[model samples]
Target: MIELKREGDVFVLRMDAGENRFHPDFLAAANEALTEVERAEGPKALVTTGAGKFYSNGLDLEWLGAHQEEFVPYLESVNALYARFLELPAPTVAAVNGHAFAGGAMLALAQDFAVMRTDRGYFCLPEVDLGMSFTPGMSALIQGRLTAPVAHEAMLTGRRYAAEQAREAGIVQRTADEAGVLPAAVELAASLAGKDGGTVRAIRVGLYKHVIAALRGPALPE
Candidate 1:
């Protein structure tokens, strides 16, 4: 589900080719990889990308449907991961190599920067269409990272923004061809890796203080 590789000062965390849904095992693998990244020595940054088809489709609906009782615990774990990314000691970038929907989009937004594939793939929040809604923490994460108008359109309309549209809306910092996505992300991460880890972390924590708090706080009623 997750593959970790080091390219000089940057760590590339690749999601295996698939829907890359946020299943328990997926979360565990991602968390374990993140722990390794955090504990590694020397200057480092992270670039997260998907192998094919999807950066992530979102939460594992099939699993959740069969195991409804695990919903709250599952969300708790998801939120924890988001908070971790938001305040990771080093800079992080999301290489959106393919479709990023719902929780998948949230995961990308949790990063410090995003680079998406322009020729294909979408970035969308379809919770409304799925008869669901964002939790308080989720809302905070989106609102904190995006402009108010962009957040409103994305959350309320469930629009499927292609890479160009997403970049125009400031959801993504740059766009590239499929082959260019991960490389662009890695280059960006490598360039930013020179910043002091503690300073970067402190700046992120200060900038996203409210969102981190909401992510770590209790979820509102669903």
Candidate 2:
């Protein structure tokens, strides 16, 4: 469910599955694509976006219902994915082409930069409305990525932010028309591709050291 494409020094990973929920196969494909990007030589950057109306809808509740026994482990893998993005050796951007809700929103936060579609889609955290609480790792990730005031409002109120609102809130750095989202993200990534990958990783790892720790530490509190 991941399509990898090359545009100059940037690698674009398109999530093709509908809604791009975090199912086992979907996660596997995403991680596998990441691995390829990590191992590639020379100058490179990464951009990820989804096909059609969903950047991602987050957790696959239906899959979780059927695979109850895998719940904790499944969340652990999800946390790991976030950590991987935080510490990726090259610059990374999220081209938020459509709705990014719950964990999907957090996935975008994990990226170094984000370009959202202005004409459509929303960036939201609906866990509170869904009667769900954030995992420890998730809480850490959100707090680390967002300013205190914005995080407070978003986590407590479950606000659905459109592109301009999200940009104002510092959730995303840029906004573009529906057709320009990915291109803007790719352009941004391409601009940063010349930086030394090793140094980029080191700097990001240093900046988000605690966030990465929480993400890699445990999915839930002890």
Per-residue lDDT tens digits for candidate 2, residues 77-153, read: 99999999988999999999999999899999999999999999999999999998888888988999899999999
Encode model 1's per-residue lDDT on 1-222: one tens digit a residue. Answer: 799999999999999948999989999999999999889888999999987779998789999999999888888789889999987899999999999999999999999999999988899999989899877899999999999999999999999999999999999999999999998999999999988888998999999999999898876654
- The segments of candidate 2 whose C-alpha lies over 4 angstroms from its true place after superposition are none
Worst 10 residues of 2 by lDDT: 213-222
- lDDT of model 1 at position 199: 91
Determine the C-alpha RMSD for candidate 1 after optimal superposition of all C-alphas. 1.0
Best of the candidates, lDDT:
2
Error of 1 at 87 (Å): 1.6
- lDDT, candidates in the order shown: 0.92, 0.93
In model 1, how many backbone clashes occur? 0
